[model samples]
Target: MRDWFVASRVSAGFIVVLVGYTSSAVIVFQAAAAAGASEQQISSWLWALGVGMGLSSIGLSWYSKKPILTAWSTPGAALLVTSLQGLSINEAIGAFLFSSLLITLSGLSGFIDKLIRWIPQSLASAMLAGVLLQFSLQLFSALESQLILVVAMIACYLIGRHIAPRYVMLLTLLVGCGVAYQLGLLDLSSVSFQLAKPEWVSPDFSWQALIGVGLPLFVVTMASQNMPGIAALHGNGYRPAISPIIAWTGVTGLVLAPFGGFAFNLSAITASICMGKEADSDPSKRYLASIWAGIFYIAIGLLGATVVSLFAAFPQELVTAVAGLALLSTIANSLAGALADAEGREAAICTFLLTASSVSFFGIGSAFWGLSLGMLVHYFTQAVSKKKQLMKT
Candidate 1:
């Protein structure tokens, strides 16, 4: 039983890494290309990011005894695709360093900590639910193309959950892979055994690069990534001094910035996999998932091209389905948390809908806007109710 439990936790970690890298790695590549990186430099970029996320996720999860997974800022990567177009690789590196420094200072100042504390729990959960809703919908929407593969994986997941809940995700993943392979959907020709060559480029700072790329990168990463990450931790009942963890990620960014590690922040969507009962019936053991994810991150860093090619072989629909099924429980739990309190229900629901809409403004994602709007609704409603009671009395 103990061995089986350990296996489940381990599988959860892999799922987090799998979903994370395959989902946004293309954007990271585009960001690197925009900086005019050579093939070797692009390999270095992946190596730095993979290792940075691995070390931070493992160290933070182990130290905090919580499933605190770190990820490269997807939005930050997208920002770089356009922002770094005219910048030298050295200038791009400078922008990366500047953004990381600001992130570190934000953590040290405890401003972000205060902001997170001000958010209602219901709204936090609502934001999480909203963020994950798209992935869940993708699971079924995939039926249009890979109907047999999707149906088979879903059927397997449902039955496995009833008979062996701990193995459901693992079972679903294996089923998806097996069926996809049988259909010749996987492209295994690119599989190779080679290491990603790491190259270092010293940064040359300029005001234009710093303000245009650095400052905006900092804003988007903090608002779009770290906030939701902390909310995931809180929503799942894991609180371990998020302020310091945020600082640590910034510190990691500072260290790896020159090597092409643009941004490192807490993971919002993927972290839920490790936090839930699917990882371990005992929440305490779920930290192992992050630890394993860290180990995989390091391996992928060392063999960036090789391992990534292996993940790339899996069909897009397969990745989408597995991610949705793995997140099902987390999504359900988040919804329950969001609506659990009558006083905060309106605020939470609004937050959920806005976040699910995938809205963005000023380069900031919907997660931030949803939380902000929800906070306003909650406080305004409470104040109006108080005023009406006073008048009646």
Candidate 2:
């Protein structure tokens, strides 16, 4: 209804889409390029990913009345950049199918929820804070390169935070664009308006792809993407059924694999924009922002080629500053939640340090390791406490 179409919700949705594309769309393009996709095939990949995220976002938000945002697995895309080498496009599709099947089976088995429940809230929040600390830190590191641009954006953000809090990111983004244009940082000469068409590739299964690409994609998507996503939701005091959402992402990814939707899952960093107070003060109404995100995603799918040029026009510094500014509040909240519990303070700090380090073991990412390590420390501390109590008694 028109009543739900507030300016803040609309702005939040726009910010979510902006962060999604700016953060990792380039990496996704590289993955497709690595898989030997032609221009048309690459366009179809964007089309499939866009459409898959769009429809699933809309449907899930409607069904749950929560701001359930979906995204292409950025970590999975990065994995493909390395693991997908020497694999044919058809074989890559087979790997995608295998990953989706595993995601679906994990959801159906209800094991994911149980595993998530075992993770302490402090540890989860710590991992999210650690994951996001990089972006917030980027704000200052960027000043070294583009002083005026970063300073102006930060000033605008501080001013907007005090005056009109709901539109802080929107205002900051506008200021960044204007400043970038004045500095001659934007390059729009290559920009074009073109609609993308989908091109499907029939899958050819191979055990090599299943082992190399599929397993890695499934693990990273679950560990890196969905884990923080669920943590973000819990940190914000929203608890929806996790299994069904994961299953929907699986089904959606499976449906769009041939068209180049490598993987789809709950978003971590970007979803926080929609889940936070920036989206809407009333949690019940925040779903509207996600609906708007879905609408923008469908438009992005339709205007696939144009998106490439559109995003390219802005300087890299501008994009990084804007995303960092947009997430400042969320990062603050995540860190606060992470350190709130005294019992798990040490464990949480360990998680934060490990995750922020960005170290990886085997094919898995730092988020998983951070959580695993923190949980181990927490259990060890609890056992010690129990033994001490018995000795005292």
Candidate 3:
């Protein structure tokens, strides 16, 4: 275990947790606020999420021999920001329990795996591509605000790619920090290390909360979060069985939800960082990165608000640039896969466009819409062509 604890992999793991927290930890905070959670309760939320994600990610990656990363449901957090309103914290906990139960059943029944197995690789790749398009684009968008910082990061990535491809992300991260410090962009003076204590809210089950919050959270977490997450793993050529992974996250959520772990699912975007070549040149060794990520996550949970302040101190552009750089190869590979299949070309393109739009309806996200539409279009076009062939015959 200690043999593989190299700096490059450790950095990769840190980047994964860093990206995950920076990207959606704020949303989690807002969701807690929506539920009218007090200060201590909010800290509990962070503790639950961090600990839950860490345990599942490490367990799955080690057992499965895949760089499997788990995350709090960002979409579910977004939904809670609105739907958690007017519901007591106890009811919200009940809703979290109910939703996690649904996810567990879905995984145990093998439905999620079968459904994912049914998706065409082309469309799956398209969905993954669409999901990452924004992050890749954000890299350059950061340039407008911090031209030198972003440029230095980009240059570091380019140079590192040529000479030391495996360490590009780490080197880029260092350069981004250096540039940011030179510009006085970081503010860490207010950061403090305070361990978070978990407080379990006894659940108050209500049909109203179940139907309103529980059900919708289940739907988005599955369709938007889990689906894309599986797609990401598949895109990157890591095919860990989907059912057990989902089951693990659902089970973890069930255990920790009362302490404010709303939902946990397979992570797509941040997981990609751990699975990338930047984590390690050898794919099999990448699991070490995820294990390292799990360690970081556990530290965050244990330290709770203490670490969040540290994470928040970094400039937004630095985060954006690193995330974007880390994911470039993944985006490119997914695009290649999406376009590789001539038979599914039209469907793949449609899926890509729809998912990249980031549209949502009825609390479901664009990934679901794109996947559903892509599958429909792919099958419809095939049927039409077959009918035409029959007519000719």
Candidate 4:
């Protein structure tokens, strides 16, 4: 293990993973707060999520001997932010438990896995492209807000990629920090060190919350988040066992639900960070990177408040630019895969555009709608092609 860590460049990989994961921490907190959670509840949420992600990443990656990472559901977090208005905290906890239970059942029954199997590779790729397009565009779009920071990061990324592709993410992050500090954008005064303590809450079941919030959250997290996450892993040339990962996430979520782990599942964006070449040259050794990530996650869970404060010290724009740049490769790969098949080109285009638009309908986010419409179009096109082939025959 020590040799694996040394060969995989564990320190560099850890820093890269840290920057990639911590960049989104603030937004996660904001989303949790917007979900009607109290400050303590939000703190608990972080604790649960951090611990769940940490343990799952450690156990699964160790067991599978691959870089399998787990993360809180970003879409599910956003869903809670908008949908939990006027909802009780107990009810939200209930919804979380219910969702976790449902996910657990899905993993056990193999229904979800079977459903994913039926989805054409083209459509899955398209859905992934749809999900990630906005994030990719943010690389350039963020320049409008913080030109110097974004430009510096982008330039550093390009230069680093040319010189040392493995350390591009690390170098870009350093550049972002330097640029942000030079511009007086970072506020280090707020930084402090402390340990995070988990606060437990009792779960209360509510039918209203279950139907309105839990079911939708579960569906979106599993479909929009986990589905794309698994696709990303497979797309990236690593095929970790899916059932055990999902089941483990469910188990973690169940254990931490009362403590405020809203939703735990496979990660897409941050996982990509750890699974990429930056983590290791030999793919087999990449599990060490995940093990390192798990350690950081546990540290964050133990020092949740301090971790949040430290991350908050950095300028928002700097983090945004770094995140946007770090994800460029994954986004490009997803786009290429999505449009690879001529038969699904139009449908894929539709999916990409709709998701990038960030439109919302009936309180559900655009990712779901984009996938739905793209699938509809893909099926229709496939039917038409079948008919034409029959005629020719």
Best by lDDT: 3
Angstrom error at residue 294, model 2: 1.7
TM-score of every candidate: 0.98, 0.97, 0.98, 0.89
Write the residue-wise lDDT of candidate 1 on 133-164 in tens digits. Answer: 99999999999999999999999999999998
Regions of candidate 4 where Cα sits further than 4 Å from its true position: 1-41, 85-87
lDDT against the true structure, per candidate, is 0.92, 0.88, 0.92, 0.75
Error of 3 at 375 (Å): 0.6
Q: Estimate the TM-score for candidate 2.
A: 0.97
Off by over 4 Å in 2: none
Tens digits of per-residue lDDT for model 4, 272-334: 766667666677877777778888788888777787787778776776676667667767777
**Which order, best to worst by lDDT?**
3, 1, 2, 4
Clashing pairs in 4: 196-302, 196-303
Cα lDDT tens digits, model 3, 60-158, are 998988999999999999999999889999999999999999999998999887897779999999999999999989999998999999999999999
For candidate 3, what is the TM-score? 0.98
